[model samples]
Structures are given as structure tokens and as C-alpha cells.
Target chain A: MKKLFLPFLIILLLTSCRHRLVPMIGMDSNGDEVIEHVSAVNFKSSSADVMNLVAKDTLTTLSNHKFNSGWDMNHFQVGLLINTTVGPLAWKVSATPGFRLVFKKVKK
Target chain B: MKSIILIISLITSATLFASSTLPTDWYQPSFDKGANQNTLSTPSAQADEEIDHLFSTQHKTLKRLNKNANKKWKVTDYVFMLALSKSGLLGFKALNGKSVFQVYYQKKKATPVKVEESKPIDIFVHEDMTDSDLQAQIEPVLGALVATKKIDRNTTLSGDIVERINSVKQVVGNLEASTDKKFYLSAFRIDLGINSSGILLPSWAAHKGTEVVLRLQWTRIVKKGAPKALAYKSKVNSNFQAFTESVLKDLNKIDESPLASTGKKAVKVRIGMGVTTTDAIIISSAKTTFMGNLIFKRNKKYKPSKSVVTNDYQYVIDKSIDGAKKMGQISNERFIKGLNKAVKMGGYFVRKADNSKKWKVSMLRAWYILSVQGFMGLAPITATSEIELFYK
Candidate 1:
């Protein structure tokens, strides 16, 4: 029985070594996964003078990849941004036919 | 002394067996020990639970990834096919719409052993030659070539021929009639032929199941309201067949794609004018606004490009039929001019809905009609149409 146990243990060890898991990750300066959050705001004035009081407030919120709504009765576009360990993704306002007002996270 | 020896032997064997098999119970320590024994023949309950949870998460993640991949493939394929169709039509039109002919000859078992193309071949009609004489002349030459295996005995030719002819004649009893010129069209003759003497194979065998050959001939002709026998002379260009086969190959690839799936949901978009009124004054007491909304919907597994998604909150107007009707028309030239100015300003615009129009609208009213005729960054669609309304 003792002789048989030694052979079985050796076979089990060989089989277990073949199925080891390898981790897939990247090494940055800190050797950790990188993730960031972003928020941006957009404000604009109405040339027609319909909502003049809030236009300045609207302009303050506008930034790269972020938008925020201004006061009520005001024409403004606002958004929240999220950046992750993966590639950057954007969601933004379509003010013109071909352009997007986008917002992104600040580098940590 | 013998009885004492027997008792000792039993006690020794029991200890060896007890060490070999661990107890099967829920206690953690006992379960762990049992896991290492070959004869215990049971797994720990916790291990089963861990494996189950791991597999469940993996299954769910794989499902989501598959769906996302499939959706992307569907959208890309639809766009690709639309592009290919346009490309194929444009390529053919630029070439003066010339017809192509291909021939294949088979020496053994109707297999096209040799294939060739005759492109841009001129069709000559011997006006004075009798139909029987023309046929007799061509048949002998063709037969001789086949007999010598110079041309495959099983060569097939197919093509389309378009032509128009006019002639002047004298009338026997009265004046010749004035009329439009007559037209004569020859149907292309396509066939599969093998040149047993050479190694070139027919286009049919090259394209395999992707293409079908069509053969047309000029069996009869009408000239000046009289029925006349038709005769045709054909010149062959061998390269045209290969060109056509290449085109057909691309078409087959497009058709086999997932975009070819029928009855899938389609994304529909329309751009028109919308007019509205506001209380704020620009240069006068009240402002009259005429604007366009680039209204859209993703419509089941469809997502619009980010540039086309109207993020200007004003464009999300409340549901109203009157508002929708106003969306159907512009106020006047004043409103249209003002709207165009706003468009030039680059901020997205939205229209307001009145009470009467908003209440009677249908669920289809969920979609907004874009005001501009040409929207940039617009993806190719599987189907598209436009509607124009009259003032009446």
C-alpha cells in the first residue's frame, strides 16, 4: 500500500502543474490597474435674448468631455463622464450636425 | 498464546484501514481529510459551491459579450452590403455598360476543362447574306475547331447584345413612309465549354455555385414592318469573363454576410421643418421661431452615431399633434430664414408642442423628424424613403 501511494502522489503532482493559471494584467508606474472618473459642464448664451440671465452660468459648466445644465429657462447642455481601467469612452451633447461636446476625467 | 497473537493482528490491521479512509461528515476538518483519500470517494460541499458560482459568472459574461459582438457584426454587415451594391453598379455604369461573354469547353464528362472570355466583341451583320449561308459558314468553322480539340467541344458562351439599325428604301407603288428608326437587340449567349487541348477552365467551374450562365440569341428580327431572318457575327475577348467573375464573386460575398438576414428591425429617419412661437422678444414684442429638429430613434438593436444623437435638451419636445404638424411645415419665409440663421450659429434647436397637436399623436409620434435635408455622418441604411407634403 505504501509503495502504491508514492506512485499516485507523483502522478497527481505532475497533473496539477500542467493546469496552473496565469494572470493577465499590465504594469504601470504604480503596478496597479488605472481608473479615473470625470465630470464636465457646458453653458451658452441665447443670441435671441430669450434666456439671458442663465447663459453665463451655462458657460461655466462647459469643459472637455463634460456638460452640466444651467438655471431653468436657460439653454445649456450638461453631462457626467466616467473613465475606467479600459479604454476611454465618451457620451456627449450633439450641438451641431457633426460635432460633439465631450467631457473626460482629469488625470490622477 | 495463539489467541493473544490473533487479537494483536486484528488490532494492527484496523489502525491501517482507519488511516486509509477518512470519515464522511460536514465538519470542515474531516471533509478536508476525506478529500485527500482515494477511497473516501466524496467531494467537499464548499468546493462544489465555489465551482458552481465560478461557472455561473463566466456563463453570464460570455453571453453578454456574444450579444454585443453579434450586434456590432449586424450593423457593420448592413453598411458593407449597401456600399458593395453601390460600388458594383457604379463600376458597371462607368464601363459604358458593355456586355461580357464567356465560353467553357469540356472534354471529359461535361466538365469545363478550359475557360475563356471574349469581351467588347463587335457584332457584325452581313446584310446581303442569307440566313442559311451565314449559319453554314460559322458552323463548319466551329465544328472543325471542336474536332481538332482547338476549342473545347463543350464550350458554352453567354452574353447580352443591344443594337439599333436604320435603312432607306424606295416604294414600288407609292411614297416611302416616314417613321422612327427600328431597333434590333441580340440576346447574350452564355455557355460552359472545356478546351480539352488546353488547361484553362470555364468561368462556370471557377465560380462554382456562385454564378449562373444565361444564353440569349437573335432568333428573329423585324425591319420596316417586315419579318426578316437574323444573322449575327461574334468577336470574343477572353479577359471579360474573368472580370465579370470577379464582380460576381464580390457580390456573392456580400450576399452571404449576416446583413442578408431578412425582416430585421430598420432605423428610419426623416428631416423636415418645424415652426413655433415664444414669448421672449428678439427685436420685437414677441418672437416667432422656426426651427428643425433632427429627430431619430435607434429602433431595436440599432444605435445612431454619436454625432447624430441630439443632446440639446430643447429638442426633446413634449408630445403634441399640433407640434408635430408644425414640425411638418415652416411658418413662412421669415421663420425659415431665422431657422437657417440659428443653424449657422451651430447650437442645436428644438420645437415646442401645442396642446391640440400633442393629444392626438400616435405611438409612432415617438420619432422626431429632422429638419435638415442632408445630415452629415449619416450611416448607410438597408432601406430609406422620403415624404413631401403639399400645402393643400
Candidate 2:
């Protein structure tokens, strides 16, 4: 039991130190470097409604980064995925100042 | 001094780690190249070639018909006769062992028939034949017939009497023998005379025969340029068909790939910030992941699953379809405008006739027959068709 405990302790430490890469949610146009954060929301929403929620969520994300001095939050792209028990509903919204919002509903 | 240096190095390393860093493979932004972005190039050159082929075939038919004739007719003269024959304008009935020529004029709103007759002459007038030329041909025969008292001085002579006097019955006999259909030659030329006020007026107008007036009006319509208009109408129709087919083919290719099914079970919003380029924020979402609190601060790399990439491509195609729909509307408007212009150009004679109001109605009918009806028949190639073809 003493010999088994030593091996288990080493395995636990190694597993805990393992570096895991987070899923990327934002990137530059060229996609060289990316910033990643997990954002989750639960509600009944449509492609149009998701646009407003995405706007608020983006502001919250930028505020968390603390390097928001030069970034233009108004002009950005948001891809929303609504997971239902039946299937996933995907939508992309591009928000540019003075330009009309273009909503694209992605088919599964 | 050694302790201070170690502390400074540690603080600098911590600051660098907190700032932006190169993305790992799992988090690399995959740029969607999108669907084809080329402008639609219609086969106009091919359509023009088709029009030329059509005209050449018609010209060949005209030449063949003239070559087989005993007396060759001018293009306009042949067209006028063909129009009259096809329109069923010339009707004949046997009366007292002699064939009497009856003229039928078809009006869409009203049909009024009247019958009357006098002398006969088979006059072959070409497109260049003027009123004076027709008068010159008729005056000598009428003067001789009136002087001899065979016909009254004031009586309007028809083609039958002139055929009898000139012994030109062979011309009429040849025309009847050339075709299976029998046509009684009853063409007339109105004599010009001075009225009470010294104004020169057609004697037929003085007679005021509705049958004669209607026949002459129809003849005028055929002679003024219906043949050229007919040729142009055929050309426009073929071109429009070719263009419509080409546009439909292009639109169908827009969403050809079948959408891949995602087996994801949860909604995940992944917000990303560009470390090196801070111009804008990127937000992406997926259905399988629920790691909302996870952040990638290390330099470790890992490849994303195939389903994630496929989902991104689906979004790209959706965006592309939206853009193509807008372009389709613009091109459709342009095509319709061009079609209208061609129609108006082809129907120039009908629109500019002396009885324009009456002919304009005919022009509208022709427009409907040539374009509107044809377009409606091809309504399946429109937006609804696009949606069905693309989605299904």
C-alpha cells in the first residue's frame, strides 16, 4: 500500500501540471495570435436576438482582458451557436459602425 | 545587488506571460475562403451567333422560294403576301359561276363585315411602289374602259374587270396553280380625283366602303415593316432564354455541397482576442464545448477536431448565399430592362403608326406574347426555384 501511494501521488502531480490549450473565440484578421475565453449563456434566443446578447458579451470579454485601450468593440464579428436537444442553431453577425448588421444563419 | 537583479527578472517574466502570445493549434483561427466570387459572364457571343444563324436560315428560305417562282417577288412583296395568306385575310366564295374575293379584317375588340365589288386587276406592288406608281398603272386601263362605256365613268373598277381587259388572267392562273390553296385575285387601286373643294381625295374614301377601308388598313400594317419586327422578336426571345438558363445554372452551383451534420450537444461561446493585432475582437461559437471559464495562457499546441472546421465552412457558405441573392436581384432587373428595350425597338412600326392608339394595343398584345407570357412560364427559374434548388 505504501509503494502504491507513492506512484499515485506522482501521477496526480503530472496530470495536474499538464498544459491544456483553451478553445479560441477571437483572433486577428490574419489569425496569427488569438485570445481565448469560455463564455456560456442559457436562454431561448433567435439569430436576431443573439446579436444583442453577443454585443454585451463582447464588451464583458474585452473588459476582462484589461488591454482594451486600442480595440474597437463596435466593429467585430460574432458567431453564435445555440444548442438545443434536437440540434444546434448557428448564426454569424458582423457589426460595423453605420453599416447594417448582416445576419447569416448557418445550416447544419 | 544579486537579490535585486533576480527580483527584477522575475517581475519582467511575469509581465511578458500576461501579455499576448502565439496561438496553439487547437485555437488557431481558420479563415473561411468562401464560395466562388467571380462575376457571372453570360454567353452573349454564343447568343449572337445563334441570331445570325436564324437570319441566315430565313434568308435561305426566301431565296429558295424566289428561285422556284415564275416571277420573282421582292422581299417586302413576298412578306406582305405571306402575312395576308397566313392571317386568312383573303376569302373567296363562288357566286353565279364566278369567284368573288372577300376581304376579312380581324380586330380584337370588334369585327364588322361588309361586301361590295367592281372591276378586277392583279397588281403586284413592291415595297418601293408609291401611290403615284399605283395610280399610273390603273389610270390607263380605267380611262379606256370608261371611254368605251364598258364601265361607268364614275364607277370604281375592281381587279376582275382590269384582268379581263388586259388579258392578264394567266398571272392569276399561275398564282392559283403554284399553291394548293385557291386565291382569287381581287386587289384594288383607288383612283385619285378632285373633290368639290379642289382637294384630291381617293375615290374609295368617297365610296366609304368599310370593307375596302379595313382591307387597305391591314395591307398598310403588313407593308410598313412587320417582317423586320418579327425577325427581331425571334432574336430577343432566343437571347432571353439563353441568358435565363445561364443565370439559373450559376445560382444552382452556389450551395452545391451538402451540409455536414454536427453531433455537438452543448452551446459554447469562445471569445478570442488578438494578442499581436489588437484592431478587433473575434467571437466564435460551437455546440459541443462548455468550457466558458477556460483560457489558453500557455504556448502548448493541439489540433482541433474535424467537426469544428466543417461547422465554420457552413457559416461561410451561408454568408456567400446571402451575397449571391442580392447580386441575383440586380442582374434580374438589368435583364428585364434590356428585354423591354429590345421589345420596344422591334415593335417600332406598330408604336409609330398613324393609328397609333389602335396599333399600340396590338403592340401591348405583342409585348405580352413575346415577353411577359414567356417570363411567367419560366417563373420556376426565379427566387423560389433558387431556394429549392439550393436548399434541397
Candidate 3:
């Protein structure tokens, strides 16, 4: 029983992590999911149109990556964990013209 | 004296010249140039001007009458003639003792006057309306005409009166044939009554059977701009079917039934669904009921029976909610939250009612009020949905 307990604990931990809940995002007027935050490296210089273009590019990149795919539950859970833990650190070290996207779910 | 005579002679010569230039018989009644020249007629010119003025006035009056015809009678030519006569425009002094109709007819002989017939008034009547009911509807219009002095009260049985009645009848008939034939989407409600043949017994009593009935009712809003032929009945039916199937599918997902039995005997469970629509705002709400036998066995797993029977009834609660949300009546979050609360409350009540027979009636009678607040800080429009539960 002691020998099996470690494996059982690991399996339990893995299973619990598999079903982690993510925040729900609000929709825009066009029914598209709205990003909670958008940050550009040169905030003062970047116009609204430029920021919008950057946001769209970021969205497309995030969409193509397997981890950020919302359609798959396992991918979404994994993405939520990784993005929260490592996303901020990566944004700090990124080059110019960089932007960070953050999504926050609405409360019930 | 010589100067005075010369001035008088000059004035006489000027008068004679003016008389010679003027046409002969200029002072005559007909003002006719004699010897086969009847060109200059004063009375004829005066008659032409009077006729033009009469027609122009009639045209303006008709336009005003037509503008108000939606709520009043469409002014016919006969009515206009009567109005003109009443206003003294067609009196003896105006038309020289001849009626306006006679002058109109006389002018029509020389130049045809275009008289536009009144357009048919749009009316809708049920096919089941009786003759007396239809007559009652038409009586107020004729009465209004008589009250306004457009029609003579004493001459109610006259030919023009009959003609006016026939014209109204034609309008009613045409409208009934066209407008009432189309179908419309109507708001509706569903009621499910569950009855069981068990005495009001304690928890230790034996089990009994149950029966259920579903009732559906709808009311239509008949208006000019109402959507026609939307296949709304079938759409409602299909939507209702989807809702029921979803409920059944969710129920089937539960691995263990709440009412588990130890012995060989089977447990009884009852479920019901009800839908209702409000008339004023077209708001639709759905209620669900769950009932079970109190006889339970601990530490045993029971499968839900697959033989639960439901009637073929339609519902519109989900569709109505979606529509309301689309129209911005309620926020999406509130909508989802309300539904989730309803399901949770339903399950909780069902379990509580099943455990104790004493609390069953009271628990079922308790209503779960799901009040949805209006969106965008508008005046709070509360949509209340009642959740009911029952058990035997």
C-alpha cells in the first residue's frame, strides 16, 4: 500500500490539474471575446490604430499556439497555468514593439 | 359764355367717340354682340369662375377628410355635397336656386370631372363572427356620420344611405378576406399536472403509481406590423422538444439515483415541466418538478427508470429568453445565472422533498423566485420565474 500511494498521489495531482478552472471573458459588441488588457512597449508613441494592429497580431499568434487553444479543455487549462506563471516574466524581457495580453474572467 | 359753350361741345364730342367704340348691346343681360356674334357672355364667365372655386374648395376639403378617414368615415361625394349644402355654399343664393349636384352634373356634360372613389378601409374580423356582431361594428360609423350631419337622420333609409352601407360592407368583406387569412406568432404557456393514486401516508407506507398531463395555451397579438407566416407553431414545438431532450439527457447522466432501494422492489420517480408566457411583455418562463417515493434504502445504488412517460407538448421558455437577451432586456450573465440557480434549486428541493413526507407538501409549495434585473441601469424590469416540486 505504501509503494502504491506515491503513484496514486501523483495521478490525483495530475487529474486535479487537468480540470483547473479558467476565468470567463466578456464579449464585445460584435460577440468576439474581448481581451482584458493590452500593453505596448512605447505606450506614448503608439497610436490607437497601431495598438489595435498589435493586439490583433498577438491574438492571432496566441490562437495558433497549441497551448492557447480555448476549444480544447486540456490545452486551455495548461495555457492558463503557464500564462499566469511565465507570461509576465517573458513580457518584461521582450524587445521593442512588444505587447502583453491579459484576460480576466467575469464574476457570477 | 363763349368759352363755356366750347368746353360743353368738346365734352359731347368725347362722349360720342366713346359710345361708338363700345360694342353694340354691351348693356344687354346676356352681353351678346348682336348679328350672329354671341362671343362676350358675362353670366357664362361668372359661372365658370364659380364652378372652378367650388371644385377647388371640394378638393381641399376631401384631402382633409381623407387624412382623418383612418379614425372616421371616408368622405364620399354624397357626403361632400351634403356638407357643401349645409355650409350654404350650395344654397339658392350661391347656385341661383339650383342644387350643387345639378350644377355638377351640368358641368360634367361640358367637361368631365374626375371623382376619385374612396379607398377600402382595412378591417379584420374572425370567421366565427355573427351577422349581428358585424352589424354592430358598422353601426357606430353610420351613427357618427348622422351625428356630424353628413347624413340626414330622417333619411336613414334613403338610397344614398343604403349605398354607404354597401360600401362599408364591401370594405369589411375585403379586409376580412385578406388580413385575417395570414398566421402569426403567438405567446403561449404550458401546464403539467402530476397526480398519483396514493393516500397521504407516512414514510413507512407502501409505494403507488402516478400519472401526468401537459396543457398548452397561447394568445396572439394582432397588429398591422406583426410578422406573418413565420411557421411559429412548429418552431415552438421543435424548441420545446430540444429543451425536454436536453433535460432528459442531463438526467440520464446522473450515475446513481437519489432514491436507492435495498430490496427487490423498484423505486418510483416523477418529473414534470411547465411553460408560461406573459401577454404584456411577451416574457416566457419554464418550471420543472421532480417527485420521488420516500421509501429508501441506504448504501445502495439505483438506476433511474427509462420508462418515464411525457406528453407531446411545445414550450418557448428558452427561445423567449434568448430573444429577450438579444433585445437587450437582460444581461447574458444574469440569464445564465438564473438558469443555473433554477436547476440547483430544483435538485435541492427534490432531494429534500424525497427524504421526508411531512416537508414534501410545503417544500413543493415553496416558489423559487428568479428575479432578473434590467440591463444597463434601466428601470429594473423584474422577470420572476417560479420553480415547483412534487413527490408521492
Candidate 3 lDDT, tens digit per residue, B1-392? 00000000000011111211212222111111122221222223433343343333323322332212122111122211211111111111111111121100111112222322122222223323445654565456545544654334433222332333232222221211112211112222222222342112211111112122222122222244444442223333343434433333332332222223311111111222232222111123422211111111111243445574343322222233223332213333333333333333233323422342221111122122222231110000112223222211
Top candidate (lDDT): 3
* Predicted complex 3: CAPRI docking category: incorrect
- Enumerate residue pairs that collide in model 3: A24-A105, B190-B275
Question: Clash number for every model?
Answer: 53, 16, 2
Instruction: List model 1 lDDT by residue over B158-207, tens digit each.
Output: 11011111010000111111121110121122222234432323322322
TM-score of 2: 0.14
Each candidate's DockQ: 0.01, 0.01, 0.00
For candidate 2, lDDT tens digit of each residue in B1-392? Answer: 00000000000001112222211111111132231112222223433333233223323322332221112111111110000011111101111211111111111122222211222323443323444665676577556645554335444344433322222111111111011111111222222232332232332232222112101100111222234422222232332224323332222222211121211111111111110021111111111111011111111222222441111110011112122221111233322332333222223212222121211111111111111111210111001111100000
Order by lDDT, highest first = 3, 2, 1
